[model samples]
Target: MRVMVLVKATEDSEKGFFRDPATIEMMEAMGRFNDELRDAGILLTGDGLKPSSEGKRIAFDGAGRTVIDGPFAATRELVAGFWLWDVKDVDEAVAWVKRCPNPMPGPSEIEIRPLYEAGDLQ
Candidate 1:
């Protein structure tokens, strides 16, 4: 099975806070986690994204179009990073995620979802 692990951004992330010592430590821990996944042959691909300010949002209303600049409050619901992994099952994926260290100080959330396989659509 394939899974996507989504890293969610916090308010400070959207605001582009400088990396403090604690934040640096957290990032190092995340790197180590990725290393572990790679060593285990589970990691397919992963990357951290830049702040929302560098992105754009588009909305379509019928034929008309609208665009919004980033640094959007909706960033709270947007993904800051993602990891693609191959695992045996949901339980295996959960166990791997449980072993990951927290990526940031305060309340950061990571969501794990299964990827749709060719067999799944049937």
Candidate 2:
């Protein structure tokens, strides 16, 4: 099975800032954790996104379409990064996520969701 681990953005992230608990030490720890995932052979890919100011959105209303740019207002709801993993099941993914270090300063969150495979729609 495949799963996505979504790292939610913090206010600092929206401001293009990396601070406090997100110090160099934390980055190094994350590197070690990523290495662990790689060694386990479950880490397919992962990435960290830049600030929301660098992003844009497309909106559609019937035949009408409009483009909206960022920085988006909701900081906590924005995604900062993602990790794709191939795992046995959601339970295994949860177990792996539980081992990850805190990815931001103060309070932060990571959401895990299972992905749909070809067989699932059939």
Superposed on all Cα atoms, the candidates' RMSDs to the truth, in angstroms, are 1.7, 1.7
What would the per-residue lDDT of candidate 2 be over residues 8-112, giving only the tens digit for each residue?
A: 999866776556654878888999999999999999999889988999999999999999998898788999999999999999999988999998878899999
Error of 2 at 120 (Å): 0.7
User: Candidate 2, which segments miss by more than 4 Å at Cα?
Assistant: 17-22
What would the TM-scores of all predictions be?
0.88, 0.92
Check candidate 2 and list the clashing pairs.
none
Worst 10 residues of 2 by lDDT: 13-22
Over 4 Å off, model 1: 62-64
* Candidate 1 vs. true structure, TM-score: 0.88
